[model samples]
Target: LILIILSPLYLPILNEIISIITLSYIYLKVKTILKSTQKKDNEELTYSLKTHLSGIKNFEA
Candidate 1:
């Protein structure tokens, strides 16, 4: 058997983290779709998406 207790402090922090990650993922996916100039194959699409995402600057603290 297992039991878990949640802390009040953790909930808001976790929600913010998850929301940021989800929004970033969606933004990248949409940008990858919009930036392709020509029709791409599956491999090409994946490669382009990776390339576009890699070009994103690292967040500064």
Candidate 2:
């Protein structure tokens, strides 16, 4: 069949496109996860800092 004749020529290009899509999808997932984790870390840091500062204030008072 003509399909078989052309498949070898197109297969590499198809593979490249599929790989690119998969990589971008993975990259996006990792980016969102990192963003969420960073936000949580920032929130915890701020809370701890606030408590520490308040403790100092009480000690000084």
Highest lDDT model number: 2
Q: What is the TM-score of each candidate against the true structure?
A: 0.49, 0.59
User: For model 2, what is the error of residue 56's alpha carbon versus the real structure, in angstroms, after optimal superposition?
Assistant: 48
Candidate 1, 1-61: lDDT as tens digits: 1223555567788889977996787697757575773566677777766675665434321
Q: Poorest 10 consecutive residues of model 2 by lDDT? A: 51-60
Query: Cα lDDT for residue 21, model 2?
Result: 78
lDDT of each: 0.66, 0.68
Q: lDDT tens string, model 2, 1-61?
A: 9999999989999989977876676566556555656757767655655665566457546
- Candidate 1 residue spans exceeding 4 A from truth: 1-6, 37-61
Error of 2 at 60 (Å): 60
TM-score of 1: 0.49
The 10 consecutive residues of candidate 1 with the worst lDDT sum are 52-61
| Candidate 2 accuracy as lDDT | 0.68
